[model samples]
Target: MTTKEEIINRLNLQPHPEGGYFHQSYASAETTGDKQLFTSIYFLIESGNISHFHRLTSDELWYYHGGDAITIHMIHPDGRYEVVKLGMNLEQGEVPQFLVPARTIFASTVEDAAWSFVGCMVAPGFTFDDFELFKAEELLPLYPKHEAVIRRYAL
Candidate 1:
């Protein structure tokens, strides 16, 4: 069995500000309005840590690699709530890949296992300027119905 530390060193992943380890794998050179066409990264999150609530200007697609399944909790712009499970177990309702639309507030967590390794690709590329992290206090009032989950993942 491979340990989380072994995978981290093997992938050369570094601590991510969003509560995980990551390494940018690719960034297209083609530009569209000064931004790359797309960008990708290897992301790993261990159990007991949350990704935190955040939104991006571009859509992101997540692909599962190995380890435990990850539960992605998303709050859509229209205040809709959804959970996407990324894993290899089709019988268990887990998907190998899932897309997160642009400007959607979302977060992920590894449930039931030690860690999860996945790849994320962002269209129009990812930029620090387009990222927004929310606080529990800020979302509590807006999403009163989802108060429990919001507080669980939000900073």
Candidate 2:
């Protein structure tokens, strides 16, 4: 049986070069073996990892574990973006998971100055081979600046 402690110790954690952060805890064999990694979770995004935007072939589901609230911004296939708030003081009973379809751009913006804890589960697993990061400096100017509106979406 694979225990959480064992998995935690075997986690294939990696840091993003851009900024913020993305530390992954894997449940599969990414650490060692011929086994396929089925699921994993990523934490924090102080600078938001740009690599996870385009290369991930599996959908990413995120849950806000801590913080005031947050907004989930998704970059559409047509190159547009949509913003959705996760919560404002989300209750423990409330569902915590936002799905970002595979191959789309996704990110979270905090509602306030607090640590935002997010859990991400990627179907079919995530590996360094399939992972790729890209910055948004070139794309930022093209999208509408609506951080203010996104704050309202944060719970």
lDDT, candidate 2, 1-155, per-residue tens: 54323333454434454233456666675532443546756555432332233336677777765544555667766766676655444464334667778876555555334435567787767666765454454345544463443232222
Taken over the whole model, the C-alpha lDDT of each candidate is 0.93, 0.53
After superposing candidate 2, which stretches have Cα over 4 Å from the reference?
A: 1-15, 29-37, 46-55, 88-95, 137-155
Best by TM-score: 1
User: Which structure among the candidates has the greatest lDDT?
Assistant: 1
Error of 2 at 142 (Å): 8.4
lDDT of 2: 0.53
* Candidate 2, number of clashes: 7
| Residue-level error in angstroms, candidate 1, position 91 | 0.5
Query: Which consecutive 10 residues in model 2 have the weakest lDDT in total?
Result: 146-155
